[model samples]
Target chain A: MSAKPYNLTYPQLGNYDIPIGFLVRKGLGLAYTSPPPMTKQTIELGAKHSPDYVCAPFKCMMGCYIEAMEKGANVIIQTGGTCRLGYYGELHEQILKDLGYDFKIMNLTLAQYGGIMGILGGIKKYAPKRKWSQIAKVIPTVAKMIKSIDKVEDYMRKNMGFEDIPGSFEKIYKHFLSKLRQAETTKDVEELYHLTMRSFSRLPVHKPDDPVRVGIIGEYFTIMDPFSNHEIEKKIAMMGAEVHRWMDLSHSVLSCPDDNALDMLRSYAKYDLKRFPSSIWVDSQRKKIKKYVSEDMGASSVATIAMADHYAASGFDGLVHVKSFGCTPEMDAIPVLHNISADYKIPILYLSYDTQSSDTGIETRAEAFYDMISMRKEARQS
Target chain B: MKKAYLGIDIGSISTKGVIIDEEHNILASVYLWTEGNPLGASKKVIQELASQIDLDEWTVVAAGTTGSARKLVGAMCNASIVKNEITAHAVGTTTLHPDVRTILEIGGQDSKIICVEDGVAVDYAMNTLCAAGTGSFLTSQARRLGVDVEEFGKIALGSKNPTPIAARCTVFAESDLVHKIQMGHKKEDIIAGLCNAVANNYLNNIGKGKKILPPIVFQGGVSKNEGVVRAFADSLGEEIIVDENGHLMGCYGAAILAHGSGIEKPFSFDVADMEFVTREVICENCPNHCEIICVYRDGELIDSWGNRCERGVIRS
Candidate 1:
């Protein structure tokens, strides 16, 4: 309508941007640009324009959107979430427009959209040149790419500390990420995943039997984005502990529901892509971890609490709870986390992030935590 | 030759050094103001400690460093073990008071509460993004009160009724203090109120939800203030143990860690005379602009850190 081609972009969240970019370029047949990796300047730029009391993730995404716009992105897509994130789209659009930037926003959670079909229609309206058949063809490949990245990262978090050669795991991980960006087919992704996995296994490691295990759980965004949380998972792992994190695109979106439910959704979508039943999710995950979290506390609270309890029950030596400052959903999960810590007699290190650039305080707390847990483990063994 | 371990704690306000024998008995110790020069302060500390100990009778084997500038001082001293202040405080307090159930420490720029179980730190927390309830706050308040910091405790004890002051933030507390002074509140009462404000702030912030049991050991620079000690005792309704050597605990813990590390690196008092300089370089290669620190000893680059990536690393 504006006589300009659609160049789509989304805020960066770890390397998941790769899959998102792939979907936009290959599925929607639209021009896409991934924002440059987050830097201190980006956060500062974001914080400068954002409201002072908003959580850090909002500032981070605001920064990302501005950066993407600078790279010629004309259409920005913001997905719906169960938190303040649901309202961020309109706010971001308003602020950017006020700043005199001209761009179209595809906000999925805009109440006027009639649900899943309405969401699909919005996408179709924006990507009028592409057929539904062509878009459907890329969905499976996108799913596979996300699962592969999550799998590789999961393994890397658990084994990076013990690599016989320092930086061996990181080196392979970097290579895999580059190869993943070039993948044009599902087979290419599968090959790269397997190759990276094999290289990881082949790398010699000096891990002791029953090494200290630490689980990371908290707000969805800050926990997954390394820069947001100061690469805390890697920091803890490098301190001679195996780190476990379960919040990612793979776990949260792709593989959450059972296969049967997924198949049912697929059949409904195939019936002319007219329906997407939210009830099919059915809170099965909640029923499974009802002891720890009965009612949904909103956003990622249920997932955070359930995973914390699971990690504690499974004999994790420690837990690290990372959240952005003033994150209501994660803040609500603290009392529950305390109970879990008491029940399992495990220590939990609580880290809250703001826009401050210095990490000296974080480093001190992390080091002290590691020392306490390792000492506790040794005392138990003796 | 008798073997001894040396530990140094270079904090923002003060520098502390201690030399201990195999049995954990202190051979010599020194405490001095840091004066915004950790290297210079630590050098003076080392010289004073060396003068107190007979060099011929005891040979220092392992050295350790802790506190804010642990790494900088550790590199200078060739310390075999470098540890954070929390761990050092826990180990030192637990070693001294084996039954210490909780350790409440208020330092120059930060405060922390460590919950101990069976002489081991089970859980701990430090002040985040705030310095309202720490030693520097009290010193600044002391200057405003026109009283010596050393005499603050005695003056506070003389108050029959302590004034209630805001303790949520340093900025807020400063304005509140000025307001109270304008309202003609007794000086002793105001000072006592400031002490109470600190204790309450610490309890609500750093010690929130922490199980503070009996046999609590209060340490750090603030522990020297009887006003704060009294405030804490009144609030927790428990006996707070303040050791004479509490200020030296961090260094003492470092010494113990070095001794237990079982790696002996010979130490000499002569290192104190060598030139130590630290240079901060801001990496311009990336937007992160990480501040890389380079430590030099006698004009030779010995250690460098604070770089977050390969691009920021300076090839000395």
Candidate 2:
């Protein structure tokens, strides 16, 4: 246990921070401070402290940790993953300590915990004053909040472009998020979710019957975080295309994998003993893209390929494969993406982002891609 | 009076302009270096184009803009359409060569490959996170060799045995070129090798997994280099077509688009005489620090952009 009163913070990943903060404050009985909203300065700070060759997500997280510490957070949490992300916790701790920050790193990767119970116990150690029953009471609300956030965003991505009033959907979305931040119970989240959905539907939209649809699939972190990917989803959606993305906390983590598929996928992992997170989704996705990939390509490659193939087969006009620069797992999936693009005859824009702040290149490419797809659609119809 | 449409492609290294009459016939064209001044370069292009065409006979009704400075130039010209270079090039090339299946473009600092099917672009890829295998690289290498960039093609054609240079990155290729120079390789051979390196790098990077079928059209500033053309031909084992007006294709397409758009925003050569200026204001409202660009004409703000939020809006 930390000697100081626990004030917790985690790296930002889109709006997922809201639910995480809810959990830490309500469930764990610890003071939770949401990391400062990401900006150019955050990225610059992160990049300055990070190793030159490390993936961009590491740099982003590093920046968040420093800012959170400066904002009075003494406990930082880092999660484990299958890729280099699995080792980020230790490195972040070492680096932060070297920088002379007095903080406790609740490195989940180093915790001798296995699955659901393990995660609970690991977090329980910091909230010694709070009973397990009290913590258990808040889990449902946290889960509901995550699902509601994803649901609202999915609708926004699909319909934001077509709204009659330019910023109508965005205004509602912002309101929902602000209201969500103040919600205290499951009923509050449920009511806010229903009200937001209703408001979204009531907004006047000029959607076409056969609108241009673009699917986005890529590395988990970069794909989810709008800041990291330069708000690509919003950019494309605003360009009058319906954007669909299947990789999210709800799909990848909240949903349980089938036990049978878990057994099959475990053998594919080098260490068969570790609990397979989201194995069912990966296994199902792997099955769909079996011809393109023979086995697991590691990290989120399976989800990326499977979602891409799904989008292509379902008659999507375009696909965007986004990844941070020097991301090996996503890089390995490029050959498979190429094959899918060929087989489906769908155009895929490969966007690899580094720490460079200039968005001109991204805008140019995205505009061109939108033009090409919309023109192709017109030609097909004519 | 004959009605014409104007198009301008203001790129990083060069600015090209074209005026086309009905039926997409080129009435006048101009090409010049941007020299880090898009506004100045575009003004000069317009002036040169105006000099070539008789304003008394033909009235330019609509204008379009393309390339990196499309928005800036578009706003300045009151353009009917401002399209990206990829689509503009594809449309222009496909209009000229209806059967063209591939369009290869290597501009000053960027390169892209657009795959066409039935006269429409179906797939495309641009060089990402790198400016390698582009025209500016070749120009720099030409300067280092103490040779005019325009003479590179003819000199490369003279080399029987081209020295092999690294094709992966600009830095690697530079070091390799220096090493071969120290190793006593001939200038012509090294130049030829650099041309080949560009073609190979383009193929390995932008052209990766893209189908480069027949009726391929190679255009852009670099396309004028016969060495790169030859190199592309050799690497792909396919005949590459370079049009006489390939460099003007972006502007030509823009003109076509403006004409097709049916929205007439009267274009006048008087824009060349107008004082247009742009100022960059770094918004200190928040941490994003968006560099909002405000465009002015005769010292009055006309259009402003680059602000991501309402807080950064610059009111004139």
Candidate 3:
């Protein structure tokens, strides 16, 4: 078969810079595009054309796919999932084909065929020029780059508030990403990692004696997307508090399964709450984190309560809970959060976001919440 | 001195505000139509709340804002805590009915289903995109029928043999209603069918994929309609409870959040007197032209956000 040059497009979640950057470094794909940001036009188009009563995210993705196809994207790379999203790829492909868009779709998530060879085979279908050995050579380097990116983000989450100058971590983080994209070897990756970590460590900073720390608890998609929650964590952190967010794709898919069994055992022993049966391992880990960690485990109900309890126990003075407009897991957690708020006597802020593109309203509320918590803290001290 | 807490809830249709004591007792509450101006309506609600409470006797210490406009009103009131309507409503309703398992909230523009497990919201869904299930759709239909919106429930309840109206989208429902009237169907029967349509629309849309258990609380503006309430009760085969203060749940939750915040500071009614304006500008950076909004407080730029890029950081 003749080699056909293709560009891949993935669904937009958080910042696509790192993922896009990773793809570029490997030279597997010529170019990539993140789905267009959800806007009024996007929603209107999606709702008008999509099947009535489908989940909002489905319509959103469909809208993005249609727009991307119009923008001259030839090949789309979709991941498989356990949820309804997994089935969406096939339907989307069919719809796009019906619309007469000539393109190739690379679905990474095939059923239960778990192995690196499968993934390699899938990619090779589009890029037949690259040998398996050549692709294998880039894996370790790509893994190192991912590690470096996660480490920088982890450090920034904890110490970003303490920086003497605002935007210091952000500046260094940008440079770190640039360096990671340019690195061709493990040694280069290691050098850049150390330099980024050193800059993060040495950045001018002062730790507050008792800052108003808050943990962000929410659904996976809304929590990761800054636009959805109006960049709430950053807003709360800007109020001079260390913000902790434990939910991410890396944590949920990569780390949570191993920690789940241990967490379940801890929960059964401590809380005697045998409620979580969805995933025994996840429940147990949630329990252990709730009991042992200073912050919440970032599950559905447990995430909110843990955040509330930690804020109060740590004397952080406040908590902020955010979710998509209609997320199910969070709806179940709100009442328990009420009792925790009452018992701990720490203020909690709740925000539900839809597709509205206005941030003026969000900023105003965050500012007011900060002012209230700060004044309350000052009053208690006085 | 007795300390007071302020709570504000801004929804698509209305803005509500409430002042409560440390014991969670409501001192003053105000509800008014939003009129497409959340900023103005919130200011009015706060001013009215301030007028009811003695500024000297009770010091407004901690404040909270919730609902759709929580962020905007929270900023206007300088709230200590700003939360979502789910948390706010769950907190507010649970305080009144500790065993509430389900919360059905239908407002002018949207509807939501919040599932509570052990006094906490665990699962929830909201319908903002579809108009068929919300109160605004009902109100517009009531106007077309030349029936008073307030009497919708009574008329619905009076029906003996309800006529079937095509109740899917607002357009289809309107045409169906017109057809039913031309066929000489009784007004009360048509009204009853409209109520059923509302309930059916909600169940299929917002209530989809939810295992709705009861000790359910029906809230928001539409809860006032007895016919719609009966339809929900009939459809679910469970009794629906509508609190007298259900419309104020968002504000009530905000008050409770503020009171529990443990802040002690005096509030100034000067918030109502302050001038705030929002200006929207499009970002020219890259292909995505993001419209950024800048909020100015008394000629000083308090905050600016909207552009995905740093191009629109500076304002002229």
Q: Best-fitting candidate, measured by lDDT? A: 2
The residue pairs found clashing in candidate 2 are: none
Better of 2 and 3 by lDDT: 2
- Compared with the real two-chain complex, what DockQ does model 2 have? 0.88
Q: For residues A1-382, what per-residue lDDT tens digits would candidate 2 score against the true structure?
A: 3577889999999999999999999888889888899899999999888899999999999999999999999999988677888889988988989899999878776344665567667878898789989988999999999999999999999999898999999999999999999999999999999999999999999999999999999998999999999999999999999999998998887663434756645634422223234454676677767788888877888888888998999999999999999989899999989999999999999999989898888998999999999999999999
Worst 10 residues of 2 chain A by lDDT: A267-276
Tens-digit per-residue lDDT, B28-139, candidate 1: 9999999999999999999999999888889999999999999999999899999999999899889999998999999999999998988888889888877888999999
Predictions in order: lDDT: 0.89, 0.90, 0.71
In candidate 3, what are the lDDT values of residues A43-162, reduced to their tens digit? 566566666655556566666666676765677776654344556677778877877778877766554234446766777866677666776676666666666666677678678877
**Reference-based lDDT, residue A56, model 3:** 57
> Which CAPRI tier for candidate 3?
incorrect
Ranking by TM-score: 2, 1, 3
Q: Interface RMSD of candidate 1? A: 0.9
Question: What TM-score does structure 3 among the candidates reach?
Answer: 0.63
- For all predictions in the order shown, the interface RMSD in Å is 0.9, 0.7, 9.5
Q: Which regions of candidate 2 deviate over 4 angstroms? A: A1-3, A110-118, A256-277
Q: Give the Cα-based TM-score of candidate 2 against the true structure.
A: 0.96
- Which residue runs does candidate 3 get wrong by more than 4 Å? A1-136, A143-173, A190-382, B116-122, B165-179, B208-214, B283-290, B302-316
What is the C-alpha DockQ of each candidate? 0.72, 0.88, 0.06
User: Higher DockQ: candidate 1 or 2?
Assistant: 2
DockQ of prediction 3: 0.06
